[model samples]
Target: MRRPQLLHLGGRPRQHAEREPRHRRFCRSSVALTVGLLLTGCAGGVEPGDAASPGPAALPEGVAVEIVQLRADVAVRQAQVHIVNGSDADLEIGDVAVDDPRFVAPATRVLPGRTSRVPAGGEVDIRVQLPDVACARDDVEPSEPTVALGFTVDGAAGTARVTADDPLGFLAPLHERECRAAALAEAATLAFTGFMPAPTGEPARLELTVTPTGGGSATLVAVQATNLLDFGPATVDGAFPLDVTVAPDDIAPIVVDIPILPSRCDPHAVQEDKRGTIFDVRLTLAGDPGEIELFVGDALRGDILTWVSSWCGFAGTP
Candidate 1:
């Protein structure tokens, strides 16, 4: 075999007598070559023109979108959307599309067609009209609706779909108001005909003509009182533990006795002259398990309080 060469530290050639073994020389050379190849591969993998490629688009930063109002009438569903552009650049908002088909672009003058440009670090409000089907149904859980907002950031177009997490609790209040109105309307069918004040040592009376909607004989099970001014429960005697029955379609006059209790007339309580101090009389009918609440208008509440004051010997106290 031919003699193997040894490399000196300073590029000096070693003589045959001082040369390393052939296998050792070969191993050293292979290692050096492998390391060189690795460095070359890494350098070649990166494209020279990659610097020209556009950088990743910046997402909407510090942006806030909320549902300010969600209203549903008998015919149309409406939503007032509020958007705040917290980004550094002005955002051009384009057409807004909702995932639900029931929501459509609002046609109201308050919120005209799209192309709303929100200034940097500013807020904008837009109204979106929805179909009647989009209204919250009693059977379904209240879910915050989402909309896909088409916007351009930094002059580059993009779409950001956002869901309105109701921070204001708007849906619950709306539903409650609607339900209360419906209950009041249903109770109106049982026309209130008269109000009778009791004589000395007797309780005051309210006469209501009960006409069952189903045209079947119904019984009054219980009656609860609520104060309209405070939205709290009120007191009523001869209303609960009720066992009064009425014939169908015939004017079955029912009377509820008003008590002369301290709760009905408080001398220290603020007495306002408006109709706000009314009572909501909730009547529980036999056939319907739900209570039908009827409002005693301002005029009626005033009259009732006056009668109660006279009976309690505190007349003209206010």
Candidate 2:
């Protein structure tokens, strides 16, 4: 497994001494100054689409196109597309390109010639490679990873771009599963309460309950909680069964203590201060789709806001 140490927002590596190192101080100062100036330009937003250089024109009549699976890894991105012929006459489809310099559109060879006899369900796969200049980055990964694909149909043209928001976050689809959510909640509850709060930890405890929106069987995959801002050690319970089933309208509550410095801050602040760290859950359901609602003590608001499926990890069941 490859693990890259992430730098804090301050642009300095963590685990270093509180005092800045003399040699790296100059570099850090310069980066911070540059970021501050960039913030000023962001106050005024720019208008969309320029009259001098407009996007590709609309697609020709009788031709309809849809783009899907705009997927990418650390290296490349691919898209699966489906085109439909709505008119009586055959439509010719050609190459796609993004006109902007910030976007790269590799030459493509797939062409659906003018023919109406072919079924309306024909599909195509197109790949777009990022240019070195557009993909260049120093420390943190670039947020906008994908580019727009401009399509031409029967001589009419238009463009559409896909960015990071179009794809699920690294952990989004995982949290969607109920079984994973239960497992993750169970692990976080255990870790927060494992230490004795009197000496150095907090005095309060934690409890987690998950009520499935649908009646179905589910399984737990993995659970993870990062102590991003906190310096305390996190712990887990003994190995337990992975299958956690929930009947219709049933609620399951798993209690754990969250160590808090009551002397330092109020209860609301402690809860609000996840400290940039996140508690994760991975769950799966058998029959139908559902949501898992979370509660910390009497207040009920935090939730595992997404869904999950069986084919998530290395080992998956069809």
Candidate 3:
């Protein structure tokens, strides 16, 4: 396993955010009815000799397609598929999907309010909700990930299953992130149990609960920083070191009171929050190092957000 590390998003652009899970919508196109069912409500390939069928055009042999998994915001489960049209002709695309051995099921791209069209020399990026990680072994990299690209050529609709490229190699890290989280889950469940609002400029103690799953003994390494929150051993200097251990025989949960403070003073900081309430925690079990993200419940998150605004004296004062 890779060394346990925190996931920092302070430097990441705020434009990258996954607001919510996109719903499946239909695309109006005439296609082979038999293949339409497999596309998750999208139209399928059209028959060869249909009079209404436009002659389908084939994508270039080497189309630039890759998965963009931006590990920012709450859209950690969402990914984007970028397909660059290398062909000279403009193709009207339908459903786009990516298949990888590391994932249990293929993820279809989601274009909330945009059309799936690939103009010549241009690219189209559609969001996709990643399926459950298939962690059968330690090495979870998919050897040859593929994409099922549905497109219209000369008005003819067809689906092409081609080898998808990972130029930036986003899959390996994704695999690591999910599989590591899974491993940590099997060992224990970590959460921000509770928090009470403190006066402005005063330190607040947030409770972190670690409930072991009796699978193995694990050690909490550290709690990583978030955009609007800071944590530490006693104060918000970011020096919190949780070397606490939870063995399998330990029946009761281990509770730790974490000192936290609002790291930002700008009103937009809370207004444009994405992962402000999430806490990235690193851990170690036996010799394997792993990292997991813990989140507070909705009520607690709201409470914390309100506290931040009050502490920072934002639009909504406390």
Error of 1 at 256 (Å): 15
- Which is better, 1 or 2, measured by lDDT? 1
Q: Which stretches of candidate 1 lie over 4 Å from their true place?
A: 1-59, 70-79, 97-112, 129-139, 176-318
Off by over 4 Å in 2: 1-199, 202-204, 220-222, 229-234, 237-245, 249-276, 287-318
Instruction: Report the C-alpha lDDT of model 2 over 1-318, residue by residue, as the tens digit.
Output: 001112122111222133235224333333343343233222312125534545344332333333333212221222322233333433333344322222233323233221212122222233332222322223433332322334444344444332212222322232233334443343332222222313323332233333344444454433333322222243343111224544544455443334322222233333333322234433454543343322221111122100001111122211
What's the lDDT for all of these models?
Answer: 0.44, 0.30, 0.62
Of 2 and 3, the candidate ranking higher by lDDT = 3
Backbone clash total for model 1 is 0
Worst 10 residues of 1 by lDDT: 1-10
The alpha-carbon lDDT assigned to residue 140 of candidate 3 equals 58
Model 3 misplacement above 4 A: 1-57, 60-63, 71-76, 86-88, 110-115, 119-122, 138-141, 167-169, 232-239, 297-299, 316-318
Q: What is the lDDT of residue 169 in candidate 1?
A: 60
What TM-score should be assigned to candidate 3? 0.72
The TM-score between candidate 1 and the true structure equals 0.38
Highest TM-score: give the candidate number.
Answer: 3
Candidate 1 local distance difference test against the native: 0.44
Tens-digit lDDT string for candidate 3 (32-121): 211322333233234456436554334543245555554342345666665554457766666667888888899765443344666665
Our model 3 lands, by Cα RMSD against the true structure, at 9.7
lDDT of 1 by residue, 178-266 (tens): 45434433333554446667664565565555544434454555555433122112333534344555555555345544332323445
Worst 10 contiguous positions by lDDT, candidate 3: 22-31
